[model samples]
Target: MGEVNRRRFLERMTALTATAVATPATLGAIANAGSRFPGETRAGSRAAAGRPDELKLPPAGRPQPAELTELTLAEAARLLRDGDVGAVELVEAYLARIGRWDARYQAFNTVVSRDALEAARTADRTRGRAPLTGVPLAIKDNYFTAGVRTTANSFIFEDFVPDFDATSWARLRDAGAILLGKTQMGPLATTAASTPTGERTTANAWAPHHDDVSPGGSSSGSATAVAARMAASSTGTQTGGSITNPSNAQGLTGIKPTMGRVSLHGILPLTYTRDHPGPLARDAVDAALMLQIMAGPDPADPRSLGLPPVPDYLGAVREDAGALTHPERGGAVRIGVLPGFLDEPEPPEDPAPDPDPDIDRIGSSFPRRERTQAAYRREVATVEARRRMLATLEEMGAEIVALDFPTHWEALTSFNFNNVRLPERSEIFLEHLRDDVRKFGVSLAPWINGLLLPAAEYVRGSRARLVLLREVLDEVFARCDLVTQTAPFPFDMVGLPLIGFPIGFETGSTGYPRPIGGMFGAEPYAEHHLLAVIAAYQRATDWHLRRPADPGELRPAEGNGGGPRGGAGGSAGRDRSPGRYDLFDVMERGE
Candidate 1:
């Protein structure tokens, strides 16, 4: 798309998402429709809660030209610390890249060019206290940035700027990380929506003609930016599958730290118990680098359980891929697998398979035109990815064991218990908006206007959630180190640490190949174990590094402004770099 089209696309997205149902007639009618449900007290709950279009801040201060966009966050840090690259140079590389490419991808919300460059300049003067200090990163709109407008991708607070930073963000900011911009996201973190505005026609990073797919949200832009290499790393928040889904779709590793592992203060609320603020990065190590800074105590947030002793996540996820050598990968901790899951699809085994998207959801085209053998192949390919992962684990000497599927998965999946908490959320919104509640995002009106629920239902759902969190975990972890699953939402429901990583890619109608990811869940607070397994698998695989072929290989759009994809004239295609993908193959042959 050309510059004008790009500009229009962004403008339209902002207008649509900011389209609030704040008409006086609508507000008055919704207000009068009060308490529709048995226990919901919209006014009483005056409490609750709260991306797709990425808006770029106007360009400002000069950037230092440096050929350093694709370096892993760790590699970039090493260069920064060794004085091989100045912070300003690295910052310019990213800003220059974002300027050229983001229009094609629409992955960011607000690009803080002026502030980011200034921060980079400052980092250049100071000695680093952390590895993440000199990196450029993006934050989802849900996290507050003092003085920056954090709309949460809603019309409600589109004009609302915060005077404080969310704890997770504060830590990163203090660490010397530069904020490239906020990412585009779903309205109120609700769905997987597109970019904030422009680049509507950019082909899938995998295929050009076929671009129809959920970029995945509510962390859509964060994933896209990182995958597209717009930023070194970005922040993603997950109340349900936000972090993992986007990570899976974009071929990135997203770690949803255990609840309370990271602080929540100064951020919008989704569910009191389920909200998770974490990092999305190109690899597990980059993710670990970010988590090291985010996973600690916050005096501001009571929920920030203050990690008693911070673990060296970076040390755990290393290039050495040594986690596979740990005896726990074999004898000490059992690899949890549901009986017969790997064997065949027989009905009797009764399993709580992790969160895999519905097959219909994975299908690419619209309408029941036809189901060719090609479609069937795509489905089979996804399943095969899972089997390959199982085989790899066995090769590494891990002991796979059968465990009864947890009962909670059924209810947790079928009926999101978090639904009962809706009234509370709406209440919080109204409270936050106060007189301006009507002035808030009007799109929310359809969901909350006159909405109420039976207090008893809310209570029952909360109670059921408690029971599931307590009882199911006690049983599952007693028998295994972590459970294998599709999406890991069951774990999210009860506030457990869960992760999802790409195993391979699957071809579909959208011309672009879809990512095939496997999900894993650890007992609560066992993120280290989760990270270890991810690090090992990634060290042995190349799928995560594979970038799509047609759409993005450093070529700027036909008639756009940005110079090239990486500025250094580099192609992101991992397939071209034989050594990278061959790492695991070489190891396999030697063994």
Candidate 2:
């Protein structure tokens, strides 16, 4: 066969078996969803009435809301446990901030102020040492929150309120974390936060004034909520880089734990094997704590069963990776770098112009040209930043190794997505597709395309996936403990764990600084490895510590404060009456 035909033949073969392996898992999940998983009865009870953890109390003193809001999750937990800050006060502080700024950012689709405050009150009154006691979190809209409107930011689910909490949220609530609200998301978690008509809803916290900037898709509002300090940290789910992309865009730390590390029982599923529910936090340590609480086996998700016990994430993060030797690697954390990922080749001189028909379609592609140039510059800067970060990691005793995967990265990722991911997503949403495809909005075409895929190709793709997974395990992972690259598809395809964190920043054309992010992928069930390395990097660098400028920093002209209320423990305003806490009313009043 000719070279092209040979390649085509292989592609055909690979696509045929894409869905064969995943069918059993999907059916098992559906079967088990109705029954309570082990300890689920206990989880359900805890979810109904949250229990707070007890710790040694320090002398009490009232801390300003702004000061309380500024502290990290770990810091805030210490304050809550030490009795220095009341849970009510902490929740009130975040609620006030959200009420003040969220109107402009549109980070939340629903802010459960009354519910959150009540939960906070419970946290204050109750006692025990669970990790997240009294911590406030912005949950992604896709996650089911019993009685709360769980719209997945879609018109189809606009009025839908789930009767049961998602397993991830239930775990957090049971551990004493207060639900701040449901952050806005891409309609059905398929694109950036936008209406069915494609009108943007959420704004990038770093550049809210610029309509051109993206907060990143699907998990956009989750990242915005954290970046704007509207909530301490937030939950995010990734089917295809949803968690990491937004976290990178907003300069936060996001971990897409191994697919089954956390159960996806109540999350709106995009793909059975690729959907990973995890945390977008201020830093790696915060991410670790949240993941620790979120990770565990659940009978509702058969994929989560048969896994080893969740590791000591906090302990792993606390260990100085720089100082301690990795037993297996025989050195510090072995980070594998793909030179192509970090080094961008120069654009070809005298590039071919757009075809004549293209020019006729759009008179001037200046907008396209401008976008391309800006992206090129951003990537250039990102390359530089990543190279610098590698140097820094080496200085901190990490061993950087150049490595390459066995399969063609681009080819394999495209095959996996088109053949495997699309089919699974289509299967999950087949009822919607058959009924009213128009409701899918920006994702309608993609959903339709999935329906058009040949069954033989999908089965072939599944067979190829098994081959790729074995190759990755035997070849790629054998060389390094972690791969230092941000493209999540390759790892997400194989169900491996990865972490995305801020490495540096570059000022955009709008003069607003945007963050540049780096990621490291680890072997399956090895989230602790990913977390430890990132925590060490965070400890050494302050990129993750940077906060976005609040668009609503200055209150209305009639308001008392002229500057940001977030600084120096200053009061933004006193808490309003319980009746006045409704976000819709607050936004309508234009306050």
Candidate 3:
């Protein structure tokens, strides 16, 4: 490890040790119980100590009414401007909701109750109801906050409170957004795992009630909190799939801004090159409002230099609705559909029921029969859904054309490799691994080394990947005004806007939980235009507003279990194929 990374790792280890010591015995007892707040009782059941079913349910009743729910940032701003609501009331409402639901969902690590209320009061008093003034927002734990513990979900930094706010945090505060608390994030934001150190793994709001299922990584808590309405919206940082994937799972709208659009200074680094901080909210309008307050160049972050001015993102939403028509309106809306992205070779059948006694013993609990039938049904349903979505878009006046990029497959490889070199991972291992390496086991040593070595390789190859991605993106742009595919898989599952660049296959590798989808983007500062297109689609259709029925209300029909396919594990890739598109036909046409 490099000298700098070695130092960082050591610091983190020291922090982790401190955290271990500081945690009360009671905390450790309940840590695995998946309860975040202490002294809170399970909502519907008596505590059974170690039983998972005894965990609390967040306070009930949708905090935001359907009419008030999914309010765009612009609309909220206008309300604040018009004195429709007070900042204090809004902050109080969100806090009350958090107080009730946060324990069950384990979404936040810290609640800045005093700080948030004070900030809201200041906004109401001074800003006199500006757009974001008094808006309650959650900061991802990685961001620095003065006088608050910014642990980055690592034990090593448990007591290491920063003396300064991250540039982004400071900006949000300045914009009059109240900081509710620090939301949990994956440990060091390295692995895609949802469970970060010191916090429970967040569960998908749409998934059956269980903690083991994937909540879509790194930004898991942020997405979950927003989905469950613990907070109106929250901040998340993405290095690859972090933001978008969680947003997909939680059914929230998220933006992965082009690199350099948001400042990273004061925020913990992952891959400095790839890490992007963005908003996860209920819909596109809310996301746009948050983006307006957060986007800008920061002198503290050298990467943000030479960036152009951020346009009024809210204006783009208006433009999409024909509120601001320009000469470009006469141009046909040409959208490219990359059909090759939908194809995936089936996994070789599970080694024919491993006949060995040992294999049988290990797999005894596996529900083979029911899981198989459920998987088959889900595959059929997913295929039909995608077909309907595409048909619906075409029916809505979108001119769809086949837009193929055979090289798009390279993105998955590139992103996987890029993840290793992230500074956060390297720094953690470099500083902390020497003494603890033996304790973590031989397997982890190689994995840590894999992270380090491949990170070096990724940095070396990034230039090439960027060149290839830019070339492919340019080609698509040349042929059509926009490129559309099944918006990221999680978006449909969670029900949010699909407005970003596509970077991975919609059908993920075998054994993985969910299929991934890529997004489209324009030049650096041009994300606004891309967002506008998404907003246009949303305006033309109510798809983004469709919320799944509450899990408690769902009932199974006569022959079927109303439970999610794959139970929790099976749900991962059960819906891989688009319900609408036929893989065989797309492949045959390509051939």
Among all windows of ten consecutive residues in candidate 2, which has the lowest summed lDDT? 582-591
Candidate 3 overall lDDT versus native: 0.51
Judge candidate 3 at residue 351 and give its lDDT: 40
**Tens-digit lDDT string for candidate 2 (1-591):** 000111232234332123211121121121122222223222212122211222212344444556567656765665575566778999999998888877667889999999998888888887424556788999999999999999887777889999999998998877778999998887777767766555667777776644456778778899999888888889999876788888888898999999788999999887787889999998887787688778888889999888777765655565433323563456677888765876674653344344343332111111122224456678788999998888888888888888875665556665334346677778888998889978776556556656777899877777767777787778778888888765666777777888989999897554557899888888888887888788777767878867765564322212211122122122333222111111111111100
Of the candidates numbered 2 and 3, which has the greater TM-score value? 2
lDDT of 2 at 307: 77
Residue-level lDDT tens digits of model 1 in 1-591: 100111233244343223321121221222122222111122221111101011121221221253256556765664465455778888888888778666556677789999998988888887554545678998988899998889776666577799998888887776667888888766566555322221222222333222344566678788888876678889888875888878877778898988888888887876577788889887776777677678776677666644445544544554443565542445534678864445433232223233333433212221131234444555577678878987787777666777876766566544335455456566666665465554433234323521466678767877787778766667677777867865445667678887878887875544345677777888766776777677777767776666543244333333221112222234332221111111111111100
Give each prediction's root-mean-square deviation over alpha carbons: 16.6, 14.3, 17.2
Model 1 Cα RMSD, 1 decimal: 16.6
Question: TM-score per candidate, in order?
Answer: 0.73, 0.80, 0.68
